[model samples]
Target chain A: MNEAITTISVAAGDSVETLFRAHYARLVRALAVVAGSQEAAADAVQEAFVKAHLHWRRIQRYDDPVGWIRRVAINKLRDDHRRGGRKERAVERLKADARPDQIEWSNGQDVTALLAELPRQQRLAMALFYVEGLPIVEVAAAMKLSEGAVKFHLHQGRDRLRGVVAISQEQLP
Target chain B: MSEFDDDRMERLLGAAGGAFPDVNTAYAQVQGRVRHIKQRRSMIAGTAACAVLVVGGAFALGSTGQRSNLQPGDHGSLSVDASVDTQSTPATDDTSAIRPSTTTAGSGAGSNGQGTSSQPTGPSSSTAATTTPSNPATADVQTYTCAGGTITVRLAAGALELVSSQPAAGFALDTSTATATRIEFRWRSSSDDQSIRIDLIGGVPVRKV
Candidate 1:
């Protein structure tokens, strides 16, 4: 997508700062949807970009560098989730950051609060499909999940969020 | 669109992944570490070559000095002097001849009494051992008594060397940690070479080839 990617692909002649500035925020946001924590999303996206830059010589010829990075960030999210042992800490962290009036969510207001309550698989599938804009097949592969399972988690995740958000909206003045 | 359909979910899934890291710093860190490892390897190779030269030179000088010290008259004169002093004395019986006489006498007197017979049988028992001619057909360990202690070495199929030692009673025998060579032993010696049996299990040397 960016000319800097081609420049970095050739040799030490390229400046990586240009690529970092261009895609850094988008990559982080895409990863944050998959990864629950802001700090973890930042770290995972940064690591993905760093890996991409090192392999840019080969990756430049590919049709989509952004897709490669999204895949990397998704894998990193899954790896981090597994290493965290349990989702309680990640959920608590998300809850702490989501003050309802302050932090913004991708979907809408208080969406982070509803997402934090979802099972990890559901949240991941929903995030990849909607936030990252990946096709269902790609999302399944990225998540190391079957297509049926991904769809099931997505269905369940959306229903739960709808129930929570609607209940909150009805109670509002 | 329905209130909670695919469109609603898709809208909810919006921009969440964050920006990527500073790519330059990460690349530089990896490159530096790799370069450092390569430099360390080359330095180690140079040091090894220098060590070989120093050891070779020392051995050559020591051998030359030993050759110089051994003049024609030196060893011959010492043997000649020893023979002259022993010429008048009566020849003593070899220990082999006297061993069997003591064994036969000890066995004839005692048939029982383990502790009672063992008391007087100590010296006589050792004397009995020298009578049998040593069989060279089978493997036998040669024992050497040095100033530090006694050492028993059995010759087998491979080369062995004490590459490095920390001079401790329980120091582990190891090659270099960088290399995947290691050795472990169960026994500990309180003093140098103090009554140790270097059991060559399956005839393997206690060193890396």
Candidate 2:
């Protein structure tokens, strides 16, 4: 996150507004890639931030407060996956039947679709590493994986994405 | 070859990220979610409070309906709460607990030794109760009960005497409103000097009282 940082008194329970201002959009975009839908990602991130606001006293003391928020959002996505299959199926069905323009297609390639071929942990590592641009330790913290595991997933994820990138380039119109 | 790969991979990843539509109302979403959480918590608190009140109210209403045990020798120990009037002497072998006294044939209207100061020496109301000869006509009188005590309202002969657990204070017939099948009266006691009216409905009293 090379975004500008405004200098102010940093304290626990404070900076929620500042943190939201800086990272809310980027968090939503990154989570949308992870969740495969803008709608679900927005909802998940909003709820996670709501939780963060409640526990801001503790959360703001963390080394990476935005990383904590991302972890919460990711956990929420996982929970929705486990609890209700109907909503997940409905979203997939909507995407399948929705109009072409209604869908957000990358001009180059769909990185999430490409990452879908990788293992879940590897895909998550890549998203946190590249899309959200978190460090290895932060990614490990967010994923609740060890730093070494994050490194391994990142290595494997990059190796897989390399193949995907070459293929998409060859298929270019 | 490197992280975020400056050439082909970077461009591909950036394109994918760029495709994500901007959500302009991020703060609005946070506010909405926070409000929703607060509302859900309050609703749960309100439901719990209502349940407690309902349970406590039911307990209070039920607690007073118990018939107190007052033996023959316990006359001096009789204590009456005007609110509950829960204190009473238990019915002896001579008095059937289930079969309440039901006398409605004749009261020569002469000897009522325990008459109230309100109608002093006119008719010994307590004596009228004792002179009630046990007869089959006892089947005609109906007993109505409330939260406080039982008031046996009977239209016997031409008069109505609402003999309560307390002999001194109870309802008397408002002769102007007495009918063959129904009886209406204006009763006034000390603590509850409010005029009482009992509308006998299907052998039970059901009203705002």
Candidate 3:
């Protein structure tokens, strides 16, 4: 991520486009886990990128423009969730059309479903810190929460996952 | 369960965020949305500008029309008041002689009689004559002498007010013909008969036989 930001800093002329091309895919994927729908996540990231494009002159001067984009995307998602109707409809559609051929990283475990079980804040913190490989501070900034809050969410999420794993193991035996 | 640690969680979460379905199409869509927003803002700004221009143009045209209709004698307050008061004076054989008398009375009255004479006396006398045709009221008394008696008419609140009549027996005011712009008073007796038609055209009275 720092490499991508450095590349953007070096090529200031087309920084917004460069940043979009570099980070758009990763951000969409991470937000998909947080949003629980690929389409909704993609839309949020696209809106964020559009905003970044409009305000690039000010955004390009920031320490991390991608962080700004991430924050905007997260905020968009949060706003959509607060609207209730759209988020519920999107969740219902996602559940109805649950795809079985998702590429797994841990022996075919459904990581998206596992993360969905966590609370909204914990889910976002986990996705940003682990999936997006961001530090606790960046996660806090993107989530617009304090670093201590992000840490607590991360801790709570980890404990929840551990309990799920323990329960699965016990069921298998 | 021991193997399910932070590294495992990172790997699982990272993998759950699969590759984007379509990047090129999305970038194009974002650019399109930005252009659309710009077009909408420009349209709103253009509409507001046109509305302002239309209102300003109407006001300017109205002002120009009012100025063009104003008579040369309508400039001074004294002359305007005198013209309203003495509009009912009978037209002499030489009509040009009436202009000097009207100006002389207006200038000679000074501060005593003219001040009290300028005020309107009718029940509805708030409005006064001006160059603007929008307000057509002229709340000054006008006296016309006919063969039978003298009739007084005053324009107030877009209607003709009959202030007084000396004998009221022979003179008959046609109420249907009375308006802010025109009035007709007819007097008939055994010896004399006459009709006085006073029309206020552009705040100046024109007597028709």
Considering every candidate listed, which one attains the maximal TM-score? 3
Candidate 1 lDDT tens digits, B1-209: 21223665555655333333454664465355545666887999999999999999999666534432222212222232233233211112112111111111123233332323322223344233222326311122222221222222223222221111121233322221211122222223443231211323333322111
Model 1's lDDT to the true fold?
Answer: 0.46
What's the lDDT for candidate 2?
A: 0.51
The better-scoring model by lDDT among 1 and 2 is 2
Which rank order by TM-score, best down to worst?
3, 2, 1
DockQ for all models: 0.19, 0.26, 0.27
Error of 1 at A37 (Å): 2.8
Q: What is the interface RMSD of candidate 2, in Å?
A: 3.6
DockQ, candidate 3, vs. native dimer: 0.27
As for candidate 3, its clashing pairs are none
Candidate 2, B109-204: lDDT as tens digits: 122233234321222332233235354134223333322233444434433433323222353222223333343334334443322234434333
CA RMSD (A), model 2:
13.3
Q: Candidate 1: list runs displaced more than 4 Å.
A: A1-24, A58-68, A85-90, A96-110, B1-7, B15-209
Residue A173 displacement (Å), model 3: 7.6
lDDT of each: 0.46, 0.51, 0.60
Candidate 3 residues A1-173, lDDT tens each?
42232233425566666777777887887788788777888889999988988888898888788888888999899899888756546554544543333423363126666666679899898877776666677778888899999989989998887677666655653
Fraction of true A-B contacts recovered by candidate 3: 0.61
Best by lDDT: 3
